[model samples]
Target: MIGNVPSDFRLPTSDSVIGRLADDVVLSIEDLWVEYQTPAGPMQAVRGATLEIRRGEAVALIGESGSGKTTLGLALLRLLTRTARVSRGRARFRIGDGRTLELFSLGGSDLRRFRWQECAMVFQAALNSLNPVLKVRDHFIETARAHGRKDDRQTSERARELLRMVQLDGERVLSSYPHELSGGMRQRVSIALSLLLEPQLIILDEPTTALDILTQRAIIDVIRSLRQRLNFTMMFISHDLSLAAELADRVATMYAGELVEVGKVRDVFYTPKHPYTVGLLNAVPPIAGEEFTPLTAIPGSPPDLLAMPSGCSFHPRCPYATELCVRQAPPLFAVGNGHQAACFHWERVTRRLDVWEGAVR
Candidate 1:
């Protein structure tokens, strides 16, 4: 029903309905590894990351500053810089006609068409993403034209509709240049441009970065509304845990260039099995607490990607880490239904939380 998708292409009626079909995989990544060439050595940015995004669901990748969340997102779209390469991986993306396309294998016009027509990305810096010389309307016109949509009237109307969905005055916004708009306005314009192609999967990297708290709230609201109405799959990268809890059905925690934990939002937030995830939760201040709860910072900074620690990458900071954790990296172990954590002492993490809660009382 949207843009260039086949006439029979159908999305679920509601964004709330996740896992509607067992085979409803919009995107699947397996053993994906990405590295950046550097003077010292090749820095591994994403390591053996595997994930499946169901149709019409929002998945949030959360972690500390150098946790490889952005790298993974960029790799999925094949938008990595020249210095970076997908060392080895398979990114299978389902197209409108139900054909799976290997993103890494796409080349020439096939890769270009896949970029915006099937999947679009709204990068972190909205100002840097837009052309200073081009007016907002010109941005839309150019994007549509590049994607083979040359009908000026139809493209303008579509852009207006998308801008309005993000709660912008389409006419005024379209007339203004990127520099003429505020930060929030520019961000909204980027969001509008992404939807102009009616891509089924949208990758939003730090959507609310550098915005005021009020403006961040507005962006989140707009994204939520758009997802419910349009019913598209989304994967947003962020360090904000609260935002992930609010916007995502699933939360994937990345650490040291690998996914350390993944589960339903409630499951990950309430009963996290990974020590790294627990540390992240402890760092965030609770909103509904009666007394002033002290926030606990995760011990030590993120490890150097170029010279990562042996065994578990997080073991250096994990309290429950043992001799085995120091000698062997743990693979993702099943924690709960559709939940997995890369931790050798997952049971100990649960027990530690129980003890912490009792002490808090």
Candidate 2:
């Protein structure tokens, strides 16, 4: 009896009410491997990694310090160090307007041109990323100018609009230099600059780690609001699982240099299959009253990248590890739709952990 549904309305998915669009993958990394020539020896930082960042979705890369999250992020922007090299794999980055390109094959000039227009990065450490000599206005102007927009008035207006988008005072922040602003303000400015070109994908590497609690919340809110307004995909990298869970639609857990698990945020946090992912969720401070008994922390430290362990890197720390975990590395196995984990004892651990109170259904 009902007529055609409204354009905005849609059928529900097994996951969310808004059904995922057709394969419109924006960024695709297949079998990626990045290695750095260290003083001791050549060390692999990212090993056999595969991920996809769809348009309009926010994905988080989370792990402990030295987990190679930053290194992998830098690889995406093709900003790796001199000694670091992408040994294998291809990262296919596509813009939202249906233009697809292979990032690995891009030349220096072509890559530079695509940086601000197709993709942008909000790097860690605002102190080093921004130019101390230039005013914030000039920084934004350079972004616009580099992308080939020559009008001064248009550039200024665009810069102000971007600043406003990140909830900063355009006139005041524009006039100030990077050294004059607080850490939070500097981060906000960096974010504003990243958005100057309205890039389809924004890669944030610990973008809020320098700010205080209040400022961190504000910055996160701005990111969420901007994503909703602009509908651009984000690849947010952070060590903070709680914040990542809040912002990202999907979460990927990295250990040493390998992706151990990746799945929906709720599934990873509430019903984590990977032992490393379980440890991370257990460490999050729960709200008062909703707290369970003192949670368990992983026993051992992460493996050294210079000499990664054979088989599973996390086998030393994983409690449910077996002989197979020590002798043979496990490939990512599907536990549910859109959920995968690299662990041998996932079944046994999921049953024994007592982490999830409810059944997955």
Candidate 3:
């Protein structure tokens, strides 16, 4: 069992609430834009990002470091710092009983209740997220109390169950401080804490960051197991394409704050239509290829968010760029079954499928 809830545990489920309708979608973001106020000017961190995460589906948002993957994740939970502002967007989240809540508009006690009870976010830095002074058990107690889980005995039992699920010894881990545990242990604790409230959706930002290869593999296994047992909706934000391929049901490629491609894991990896997505694939060495496959890095760096390039932000580095690409930004065009790419020369990408196929093999 995921969690042994108290007899009175319940989430708000009013049928009167209404928003944009989406069947089977747990979270739907439409035309979302986020900006950060800087010394130079406003930095466009996330731009016109629209995607739907269905119930119990794992969606990976993959991109380069500055491609706004983390920014978008933070925006969804309203966890952005004071410097950042969500300029415009509609993030409609499905609550129980066929009701949809506009996430961006929530405030005060409603927002507080929505955060841990409905959705949770595991931050990138696990060590920093945990308090140095607080013991592991205290962390669990505090989080549970904050979300109205008042029964200390029940809360501790739930925390222990979650910790065991993540492959940690509950009794031992509960007594230790954050500094006492290894990097992997801390990460596992964070994962366990995120599940303490039995959230319907969880957003993990680089959950395997700053860990050894062995530890990363362990973390991956733990995540896979948790998903199988609990079946919560997840949005995994990462620059690591290999890990994303292994964990995600769907892949959404982001470039300069815009979603360049969104499709099934197999479709996006094997037959990418966007040049940026293809470039990303070319850069990573395949896990199973026997022969030596030369890695081809995408030329140039990610554009400056303050003064973004004209038309398609990726046009400067695209191998198949045309005059039209420089003059007009391309909207996401349907390429295949549930596959979309924002590229005028997507057909060129299709012609070169053999190259990508060989790279992955």
Candidate 4:
């Protein structure tokens, strides 16, 4: 949670970072279910996804592709595609003014207005969203003008400052086309553009994917420093739990469409409570310098949402699954503290894990 905006702070007449900013609950999401209208039938991409992202914290959403992590992020921003829509859910955003914006209720124009001013998303392959023909500065200029900034001169200077904040040269980047910059440089430009509006919450959807190791490190470092300086809350989504651990304070594991486990990063990593989570952590390779060890793969593929299993979606693959797990879907059961898991065998699962953990580690 963050402190409230200072008394002297004010919303600018034009597009500027100065606005109502507060700490505490930035966004609250309840039972968010997003679906796609397919030719066969409606497929639920996100099922009863409930989460809360506090202000000034980094919460990482970890799952494989099609686990609904990306869909949930887009839903928070109300940016899901035409084929996809939120069937049922509520997302409330607490702006800096101590008022709330019901994010799920906003229409297209209202959503556009709310975005960037209150929240922004640094999308996957965001660099590709940039125009091939337009210079980088033109992109910033248009984003500013869209948000009602009249002074091209002031927006231009702010754009340059944002570029510098991301460690890119303002003059060179402003004059260059998207292709003129390397992938990492273009990604930096995308990050800078997202910050152009000074959004209170930034949804980074695998922003580090597809980059070389060295480039990834540089980008990660830049993001870490920027987050500390700017003090915006974040939802960092990734498939690599090890990589997510670098940036997140907490970790939420999604299986199929629902969150099967969530807790502090250290707790989730070192003392996972879910069988699926145990499988995930054990799947990661041990460090090269350590004693030689084997890695275990989580058996079977993810379920088909169109024809999901009757009970727990993971019971088919879970070794500890019992007959009850096969017949009745388990709700997210609280173990202790903030940790929760959806399993019929949460207690027995823990005991089996000791034997399992010894084998894997």
Candidate 5:
């Protein structure tokens, strides 16, 4: 949608400004429970997971492929597939204009209208999300026109401007279809469309997963710029911890349908408390320093959700698991400085080890 506006255009505003304007919480997920009705029975995807995203804050949901990050993200928008249902939970979204809506209770038209207009999603695959039949400008026009905020003239101008914001030439990209553009370019277009509604929050599910390294960097740059300029909150869902750490103000780690840890990005990165968090950090390639050691992958795979363990789901794979970890589940307890981890021996695990200190190698 945003093509050829300008490469030199000023980026968006920081979270600080958005925080000031809308003081109330923008998104709150309280004790969510999502389940899928498989032949084996109801398999839980999210079990009593709670999270919050303030206005303009960039939060990331990080975990493995089936760790429920995408499920949680979809639940936030009530976009789950037919088989998957929200068994128990409350997701409250307070819009920019002081309107509150409970996503679970909202029905047909309301849900559809609110989806992109108030909260939009940029899914993992670009081709799947975008219509190959339509031109870039037409897509933007359709979205903009749906809201009735901008007509043809205004839509055209906004489309061009939006393309420019994503570092694409407006004219060329506007005329192009899904196949004509590169993967990264298509992603940018998706981002631009997501912004058309000027939604208060945008959920990006593995936005850069399909792109090459260079294009991925460009897309990340665009996200950063947009976040700065737009001052909107974001829910960045990804399996890549390194990328999440680079963009998010805070990161929430999920393991086997449960939230394992959540805290400030630096806290989660530098001083991860949960064993799963530690494993994830150790598994990701370091970006800041050249002297860092190679990543260590988590030994075992996640357990089957249909018949999970009695206590901690991560007990099977966690090296630090003890009798307590195997007997009873741990709650997300506050560790320090807005850091929390669902591990009984977080203190012991975090204190006795310093993997990044060149000692673990």
Candidate 6:
């Protein structure tokens, strides 16, 4: 099932873009753990999530609902809810300079100073994030001021530039209120606001979730254009595998708070090594052949995080799982060039896939 870039696939590119694709690790996140502190007990929301994000590229976090994709993204930027906490792991982040900083280690002014200026977030429900009472210009002014933009004239100009960057008419959009704009336009404005400070990394937590299919496609195109022009890296968090397939150079599939598989989009989509990833790819409707085939389901719901099953979290739902899969936690095993999966029987799993495909015919 492995193939090179398909004829229809495309991604943003620019001569002005900084850093080679897949060459530099802009953010080094290691064994990150997150939990929600409750009276009952601390409930783990994310477990040992680890990966490195390359500069000027999109790395997508994709999985079913409650897979902790959102939590992991929130934890990376220290934007979790008050009740939640990042108890373990570290994210080493590098900005314009070569120097790196442990994001969680910094406190008070240090963290405040680094955040937004270097990294920004485009929230899930970004359309409703705007204040109904304020004008669009006011929103930009507030963001600029919070980041210490003292001169109103300069901030206004920058705001106009950002509006233009997102293909919006600066004068009209700046004068209008949030209620006046369409859902898609408001979402674009949110993205423009994220780039107001020219952050090196942008966390897009389901930016296109609420939009219609056509609107979603337009927004994705806008993001690609912006990324090409601005050269800012992105972490796209979504459940839409098709959307992830378009934007991401690399794909990380999460399951039950852990990353089950991570590699190039072509690798994970066409030649998945993890059982969970396999199930997900199978479920997605194909655009070409097999258009009339029955939609395949993974056959079971995800495990409850509060009372998670022992050993491999995905073993319960995996068709190829064995005694070893239920007895010991499997480490990430190398499957292909720069591809890895947490499965003890990945070799046997691939063979079963072939046989299963034959039976389907």
- Which numbered prediction scores highest in lDDT against the true structure? 3
**lDDT measured at residue 258 in model 3 versus the true structure, 0 to 100:** 100
TM-score of each: 0.91, 0.89, 0.92, 0.89, 0.89, 0.89
Tens-digit lDDT track of model 1 for 134-177: 99999999999998889999999998999999999999999999
Could you say which candidate leads in TM-score?
3
Question: By TM-score, how accurate is candidate 4?
Answer: 0.89
Global lDDT of model 6: 0.82
Could you report the Cα RMSD, in angstroms, for every candidate shown? Answer: 5.9, 8.6, 4.7, 5.2, 7.9, 9.0
Residue 19 lDDT, candidate 5, scale 0-100: 26
lDDT, candidate 1, equals: 0.87
Which residue pairs collide in model 6, if any?
Answer: none
Output the TM-score of candidate 5.
Answer: 0.89
Overlapping backbone residue pairs in candidate 3 total 0
Instruction: Estimate, for each residue in 112-211, the C-alpha lDDT of model 4 and write its tens digit.
Output: 7678877888877856778898999999999988887878899889989989988999999999999999888888999899888888888888888988
Q: Candidate 6's residue-wise lDDT over 1-361, tens digit each?
A: 1124333222112221233223287888889999998777888888998899988879999999999999998887788999999989877776554545577776665566557888888888865788899999999998888767878788889989988888899989999999999988899999999899899999999989979888898899999999989999999999999989999999999999999899999998888889888878777776788558555567668887888888998877777777887899999999999899999987766523443332311
Ranking by lDDT: 3, 1, 5, 6, 4, 2
Candidate-wise lDDT, in order: 0.87, 0.81, 0.88, 0.82, 0.83, 0.82
Candidate 3 off by > 4 Å: 1-16, 350-361
Weakest ten-residue segment in model 5 by summed lDDT: 12-21
Model 3 agreement with the true structure over 243-298: per-residue lDDT tens digits: 88999999999999999999999999999999999989888886685898777767
Q: For candidate 5, lDDT tens digit of each residue in 44-133?
A: 999998988888889999999888989998887888999999999887777544555677777765566668878999989988889989
The true-versus-predicted C-alpha distance at residue 350 of model 5, in Å, is 2.9
| Better model by lDDT: candidate 2 vs candidate 6 | 6
- Taking all chains together, the TM-score of candidate 2 against the true structure is 0.89
Candidate 3 lands at a TM-score of 0.92
